[model samples]
Target chain A: MFEAEVLSGGFSNPAQDSARAFRACLDAMARPGRIQQIAGAVPPAPLSPAAGAILLTLADATTPIFIAKSHDTEAVRRWIAFHCSAPVVAASDADFAIGTWDALQPVSQFAIGTAEYPDRSATLIVECEDISAPTATLSGPGIETTQTAYLPNLDAFVANSAQFPLGFDCYFTAGNQLSALPRSTKVEAL
Target chain B: MTDQAYNFAYLDEATKRMIRRALLKGLAIPGYQVPFASREMPMPYGWGTGGVQVTAACLTPEDTLKVIDQGADDTTNAVSIRKFFERTAQVQTSETTAEATVIQTRHRIPEVALTEGQILVYQVPIPEPLRFLEPRESETRRMHALEEYGLMHVKLYEDIARHGAIATSYAYPVKVEGRYVMDPSPIPKFDNPKLGGNAAIQLFGAGREQRIYALPPYTDVVSLDFEDHPFDPSKADHACDLCGSEVSYLDEVITDDKGSRIFVCSDTSYCTTRQDEGHTGRLSPEGEAA
Candidate 1:
């Protein structure tokens, strides 16, 4: 399923690009409410560059991922399966879930994780049409101060954070840009 | 050299840097299992992935490596791990504990006392002692950060209330540096006492769980116990029939169809060394009473 073409002029290996993107993810997640743009592969459509970058970075045979709606295309599935060997699971049982906000179903469908093992909660990568600086207000663990990003919906996220460590961590992916909002972050409604 | 195909120690320099940073934090606060984004190795989980990751981070080309499972260097998993290092890092491997600069183990601590320059790494399936009690990392991290250990004490206290002794015979929980209550892996309780004030640096890695923690030499690690019920590190009453050593942990082995069983030291290397040195028990051909 993987259209294996050795891309020229980029890092010699996909693993190198993966490492770089993964570092961006680590920095983005560790400091909640941060935006980091990553570019490398132009995955087939419905798989945004940002989301594709993330899949390349963190997903492997070790991680289980769930694809919802259009993101569940066979082509995309085959690509991921061939490259990462990451098992696909139901939304309720995934370590990571990918799709647009609607495709993922009710935001509450994913595992929020229990109190003692919040890290068990699934991280969602929501593909968006566009992302810009002039967005909603955000505050959380990674925020040096307060940061804001254009969110699909602010109230749902604010409600999500109220659960405290039990909420799913989210990454908003659009084009080649991505930003993270861990459960520790507190979103404010404008 | 075959090692040129991969980076030093099989892990790239970037991954090593990441693991090294986490190890430093883990060492700064002994016994605290720091959460690290553990990477997928060329090997599978439930094997020696955790120990492999830790060893990958710490190994230098000059270091002599040792790998053991159930305390024997010849065990299949031990041989596999030793071969991994040999292929990836090109480091010298040893079966003797004293000759090793770094030792990775599962389920047994070496009987030979480790010194200051040596490093011990443990393969952990689950690093959280309270994971079965509470299944949320978020809650547990908060619990640790706040120094809340009531749940652990209550669990142990209840165990005593039911059983005449603490029911957990192995993998006993320990409070390190008066802070985090860490799982000491699945070593028999007899080795629990060796966890504290040790001259060698100890590190633990749980791959699937994505956590790494450490114990610096001389760190204070106290086993949990109430004043009324002191911690008991007990082993089987019988000594090894081959080694004649009563001070080591023993694995119960059933030798025949009639259900006759013999107790042998769980630490195979230590037992073999003792037997090689002419130490023998009643069952040995060269035993004093034989």
Candidate 2:
């Protein structure tokens, strides 16, 4: 059923492309608010290049992915199965989740990890229409002083930052551009 | 084992992804030790297996890899690891501190200032700061959960009361971003100063402990100490006898049976760079006939 979808828009060079994509993701998280360009994967509709690249680079059998309703199309699910083999799990069970800001509502259902193993939390790959301009001031570990970037909702992010070592991280993607806002970053709307 | 049978960088994609995920989490919470499924590598448990695995995951076709063991690139661990990646990943390896995109270190961050985009991966034997004071894993986990670090402070205090100074030198505890008190591997206390506000992204990995922690560039890493007794980054009083370096951390070398000793820069790359620039110390090759 998914033979045709498997052959399209996947990394041409898995070794190099995934490596570069991962580097971009790493850069995005390590230095929050800094926009990094990522490419090398073109999934079915609704999945941007940056999001697809992230899924291809990070998702595997070990990681369970939750596709939100906006990105819950049959083509996207099949592509995820063919490319990464990550189980499509419930929101709470997801190690990673992908969707737009509105589709990923009631974010409390996702795992923020336990006090013991806080790193067990989910990482939401948020697909945005565009990633540019400074909407909020970001300051924390990765940032030297303070940086500003456009996030979907600042209040939600500020609340997430309060969780510290227990909150889920976010990767904001638009087209081939990407940025991240880990829980460690303190977000305040400008 | 056939080299061709191994995947890129020696680790299969799945394992790399697992490690990569752990790494992102580690970076997200600076200095917090994140548990990972540590794999058994071709090498033994103690000799930089964690750092190697981390480096393998972070490495790409475009990266220039560098490996150092106790500040020297020519050591056994460093040479073997560099060779391991060269054969497995076919990436270029360098001895210069500034040249490498990823530097896998077993103690001793390079003396030279690291720039942005460079990643420093440390081989950590013990990733937990409170492991010595409280041996039980469960209790330590509870202490961390409660943000209880009194035991570590008491340990440091006892050392000061006993020796008139913080007796601990290496593997010194540091609080990252005012949160987790982390063990910065076995790097000397003198090197601890470099841990804070450095441009390079610092990553710590312990294969035996199955833990990985990180310090993103410019992260605040405060060495644990009391208010009256501020943390002092101390080194050998003598300068590098070969390179005439005064600021760098020095390794003492016994020259003769008569108790003649000379201090040399622990960082081989830094020392070589200085020496190549015509800097000479008391025991430099052209300075004295030893």
Candidate 3:
């Protein structure tokens, strides 16, 4: 249902907010392991500001999204429907997915895209309690040298990097803070 | 007059977001072409519609833009693109390479080294380096997935066998971060070395192909070649007649009916900058007068 309260959390100024949010997302992704602050959307419960802003900026009618069970509240659903018009779908079919690292577990379920069209892969928006852990060293494209970040799991990312051009990218969100780990990044324990 | 009907930068917010998302993915997986929903622009496909679309998505009112074709600012295609953005995006335009925050280019990297915080959007006619060697997209995709670049090696080997050297010149192939083999647009092989360890972010867009890819700052971009053969970044071997610069790429110009020729710097800004610094070549206007 497109209730007023649920939609109120959407961007107040869609054009400018989305542009700014997308830039922040671009900056974070361009410089892997670097964290950026994003603001614009005030999503319903369980979604942090970074996650909300990303959803608003990237999701649309054409993009099917998957919301993990922990954050798949009725209000969140309504909010997404009213604001982004994105269809909620299974993880395998989603262009984007959102949830805690544990809730969105078995990352293998999400589409990593085919070799011919790897860009079709899903981008997972992971909610974290804190992103300042400095748990792993990240090295690869976007990183000048090695950079460190608080990733949820290093082994999973190492495996993902092994997949190379066929892995889903991830964005970790903690409140307004955001960071990304593209499949290209090489992850190692700190 | 600019068309006011279109949204800022000529693309709707949703489309820009979609493009931005693809660009990020492209950056993450350096040299891997990420498929995107390419839009129809006012210009033709080969004329840099792809680069134009990418530029439109990345631009803001605060940004200073530059567009070049064959490294010349006055080239017809470059002029048209610069005009399009000036009218539609209402952004400042610059012929000075160093002054631009975002540069959309076709077929050449600037002679002036790009710095941090700048973005280079390349207009690519073909995004796949394997497209020519293996005509089938399906087959090339498999080869890439399997890390089977043997066919490419063979192709280069064949060139070496026939020509006693690698003959392929423009649009030379590069391996990104030692992973995916990428086409660095149609820039001369001379520009290939500049692709690696650059301070600026380089993004490639192929509108007709509907793909986008990127090379982030300081990423490894090795030109594809065998150890025995070795990749050579060769140019015209002539100094620019206008700037007297031997290190820059030179464009050959026919000056007379008798078939006399002169070489000028392909990069106009670089030539002008050198001239401003009192550097003059044999064919310079002042030099000719003297």
TM-score leader: 2
lDDT of 2 by residue, B1-290 (tens): 23778788999888898899999999998988988999999899989989998998999989999999999999999999999999999899999999999999999999999999799999999888899888899998888888899999999999999999999999999998888889999999999989999988998999999999999999999999999889989999887888888899998888899999889999999999999998888887695622
Checking candidate 1 for backbone clashes, the offending pairs are: A31-A142, A32-A142, A116-B136, A116-B137, A117-B135, A117-B136, A117-B137, A118-B136, A118-B137, A118-B138
Which sequence of candidate numbers ranks them by lDDT, best first?
2, 3, 1
lDDT of 3 at B212: 93
Model 2's CAPRI class is high
For model 2, report the TM-score of its A chain.
Answer: 0.97
* Residue A181 local lDDT, model 1: 74
> Between candidates 1 and 3, which one is better according to DockQ?
3
Chain A only: TM-score of every candidate?
A: 0.89, 0.97, 0.97
User: Poorest 10 consecutive residues of model 1 chain A by lDDT?
Assistant: A2-11
Instruction: Provide per-model DockQ scores.
Output: 0.03, 0.86, 0.61
* Worst 10 contiguous positions by lDDT, candidate 2 chain A: A1-10
Best-matching candidate per DockQ: 2
Give the Å shift of residue A175 in candidate 2: 1.1
Give the Å error, residue B270, model 1.
Answer: 1.3
iRMS, candidate 1, in Å: value is 10.5
Q: In candidate 3, what are the lDDT values of residues B155-212, reduced to their tens digit?
A: 8999999999999999998888887888999999999999998988899999999989
